[model samples]
Target: MTLIRLAIIALCMVFTAGPYAEESANLTDGGISVSDKNFPWQLVVDRGKILGCVYDNKFYSLGAILILESLPRKCELASDRNGIWEQLTEAELLLWQESIEEQQATKQEANYIGNDPINDEEARLIRYLRSAKKRADTQ
Candidate 1:
């Protein structure tokens, strides 16, 4: 019960607190909302399709798809919010998209700084594995 209220409040905050809130409208299709007029870029939210709160002006996912997909090796809500997605204003959506791009750029920069082939965790694991292999060969 309390959780339901909290979710509702959160969704309301997404809609009401922003400058473009008044212009936003719930889409006729339901569970989806869009902001078209007050802002230049249209922001769309399809609760049935996406899990993450951020939208890339392209596709919707739990987080930035590029960031989430870069893993080197491998591998929620209440009633009113159960299938409801949070809609961001044009400014907010642009900011989110920019941040994701920034992160991706930063990651790429790190990869090329010294021709470094591995991250800290990967380097640590490699070191351990090499040490283990050396010990086994000696035995």
Candidate 2:
């Protein structure tokens, strides 16, 4: 009788513990929850390379296609239409874009030479001219 009671208790424990163990395993396997803040953006993988955008709020994947369509002819010409199917999340995309912008700005800054050797007035004028040139170049 005692052995039978022990067996029943063990069975009950296994049944109760099964779900909890499965839930934890699912979480570890990257099963995203809707309420999770990290779920806002995700990379849409296709063939291999990243090709387009996907806004979290959009129901369809047409956001990237529309963006590509809206680009200027010259910009469109530079895009690889065939391989451009993958998408990185907005945050990841922005981070990469910002880095590229920073690199371009740094390269531009490195190309300039100061004409004002000693005079404070000339130095101020040079700084002003450089700032104005940078603004114009960016636009």
Candidate 3:
């Protein structure tokens, strides 16, 4: 009787797990995970770096990044009024700087929204990017 019950339980487990396994496999088929594609910078910044916007108003990832774009903004607002900059070591700061630069490069390289025919706004943005890239090249 026990052997028969064990077999029944195993069969039930197999049936229940099958659908979930297939569903998860389908979800993972997308190359990049959803979080990485959407908020890659936030993921790294959150690990060690603390943001004032997050502490004060609970700004979302994109909002925080927008507010804290420049080095001065980061120096002023990356921490609290007391300041967390003093807490970061040189090595950590270097690592964070590298990560930010890498993410920026990746963002610049990516086409972002699909490459449909350029609309007016897109044409304007492309013009800006071309000029910016040209300036960087010169510098």
Best-fitting candidate, scored by TM-score: 1
Model 2, poorest ten-residue lDDT window? Answer: 69-78
Off by over 4 Å in 2: 1-84, 114-139
Instruction: Give model 3's TM-score versus the native structure.
Output: 0.24
Off by over 4 Å in 3: 1-54, 57-86, 112-139
Per residue, candidate 3 scores C-alpha lDDT tens digits across 22-117 of: 342321121233244464555435445533233232323211112122221121233333323122234433434454555544444443455344
lDDT of 1 by residue, 3-34 (tens): 67445544433433232222223112112223
Q: Which residue pairs does candidate 2 place in steric collision? A: none
Cα lDDT listed for each candidate: 0.38, 0.37, 0.39
Of candidates 3 and 2, the better by TM-score:
3
Cα distance off (Å), candidate 2, residue 38:
42
Q: Give the per-residue Cα lDDT of candidate 1 at 2.
A: 59
Candidate with the larger lDDT of 1 and 2? 1
Candidate 3: residue 96 Cα off by (Å): 0.6
Give each prediction's root-mean-square deviation over alpha carbons: 15.7, 26.1, 22.8
Counting clashing residue pairs in each candidate, in order, gives: 1, 0, 0
